[model samples]
Target chain A: DARVTQTPRHKVTEMGQEVTMRCQPILGHNTVFWYRQTMMQGLELLAYFRNRAPLDDSGMPKDRFSAEMPDATLATLKIQPSEPRDSAVYFCASGLVRGTGASSYNSPLHFGNGTRLTVT
Target chain B: DQQVKQNSPSLSVQEGRISILNCDYTNSMFDYFLWYKKYPAEGPTFLISISSIKDKNEDGRFTVFLNKSAKHLSLHIVPSQPGDSAVYFCAAIAYNNNDMRFGAGTRLTVKP
Candidate 1:
């Protein structure tokens, strides 16, 4: 079965370390989203890309967080000089819109298992 | 500010009973709502969804009811089972935006 795949299912890093998470969306899926989940915040959408172009990153912290979709299959979320407050499970989801052309933005997201990041 | 809220942190239901989980949204622009079930260490899975135009939508044993005027929605699971025990998150998507806002989630425990 096709599914969104994420690397480093678990990551542990000290404060001020650079953390990078990678995702491989299902083949041909046109929309990719990155979300962070924590006990305090629940699930927050950090960034989203449609057709390998970022549509929104306003939810992301501008100074340390960055997300990108280099190509159709690859999407990445990076935190430079990550802080302890950034510790959370990061999820990647992919989907294609229904009846509105080939974009995933209009469809329900299919999620990956997620990367559990713990910054000490 | 939290756009979506699931006030109850947890709920316990007996097997074969109906389980009701509620959600509230602050944004009137939210036109589509969804319920997602999550197991530990796994991503949330889509369970049911409803559009603002409809009052209710049902699929098998799962039914989602929407109250557009009240900005409220709920998920009903009939004959709750042990396998149904998991965290349920309520998500809302604005009519004009693709971003989906989620609630803090309610942990449902179905006892035998």
Candidate 2:
């Protein structure tokens, strides 16, 4: 089955550590999105890339969090000097959009099992 | 500020009854809306969606109703089942924007 795959289902690290989460999107899907879920914040968009180029990362903390797609199949989110506040479930989703038209709104995102991050 | 809002944090319903979950949006630019279901440790799954042009969409026992004038929407599950218990999130995409803003999910428990 074509499903988005995420590595390291769970991660535990001390504060000030660098943590990385990886995602392999479904083949042929050009849109990939990263989201953080927490008890306080149900779910917040961290970043998104279209056609392997980042379309927006405005929601991300520029000083600590960074996301990139090294290749079509591999997208990564890294946190440098991870803080305790960064503890949350990180999810990766992918979808296909045709051109720059409004039809992109109709494309439903397919999500992967998330990475549960714990920063102590 | 949160563009989408689910005022109710949790809800409980008896099985075989109707369960209604409400959502409100502040952005008038939103042209598409979607509902997602999530369980512990798993990612959210797309349940149903409606366009700004439509007021209602139904799939199986799940129905979504949109009141564009009120900037509100709702998901109704008839004959609610225990298996339907989960967190439901409301999301919307603005016109010409693919960024989907999500509301704080509402946890629903269907008691048998």
Candidate 3:
């Protein structure tokens, strides 16, 4: 029953407040991804970490959003001065990406239940 | 720009019938594609995937078809079940790239 775990399934805070979402990836998986889903934007990649190393985070807002993999199992996304525009369901996913030139480089990601954040 | 696109926002099918969900991508560099299913208040789950080198892939009751020339892909479910009703998302992976782009998604309703 191993799966990606996300905490604080729901959150509500006033504008300008800081919000932190945590994820515990499935053990042994080396890749972690963060995504934001909203009605207007659909689903978008916020960032991802591979081998505990940040890979592509260009999709994330540099000034307001930050994502980090402090350890292999723990990945975190933090939003400072959270705004109503940032309210959305944040998902964390993990997978074992095959090394380069492995025929298949992208491994299917297993996502967690997600954290629903509301900035009122 | 939307690299991946699910043109139809929603689709409906009667139970025990065939269900087809289509997705199109504009990125020629995309080398792999994946389909995911998501229910309300939950994360998207991986359903199936296919590599650019292959035209089709199948498992049990699900099958995926890819058309590289057209940059189109489709998911087919035979004997659609009530439980199969969910939002389906289309995703594409570029070569040697870890950043995956996703389509808006299509909501599928299977009537019993």
Q: What is the C-alpha lDDT of each candidate?
A: 0.89, 0.92, 0.90
What tens digits encode model 3's per-residue C-alpha lDDT throughout A1-120? 789999999999999999999999999998899999977556899898889989889889999999998888799999998999999999999988865322445457889999999999
Give the lowest summed-lDDT range of ten residues in model 1 chain A. A97-106
Which numbered prediction scores highest in lDDT against the true structure? 2
For model 3 chain A, where is the 10-residue window of minimal lDDT?
Answer: A98-107
Ordered list by DockQ, greatest first: 2, 3, 1
What is the lDDT for B9 in model 3? 90
lDDT tens per residue, model 2, B70-98: 99999999989999999999998887678
How well is each residue in B1-112 modelled by candidate 3, as lDDT tens digits? 6889998999999999999999999988888889999999899998999989999999988999999999999999998999999999999988867667889999999999
User: Against the true structure, whose DockQ is highest?
Assistant: 2
Model 2 accuracy (lDDT, Cα): 0.92
Those runs of model 2 whose alpha carbons end farther than 4 Å from true positions after fitting are A99-102
> Which RMSD values do the candidates have, in order?
2.1, 1.2, 1.5
* TM-scores of chain A in all candidate models: 0.91, 0.94, 0.93
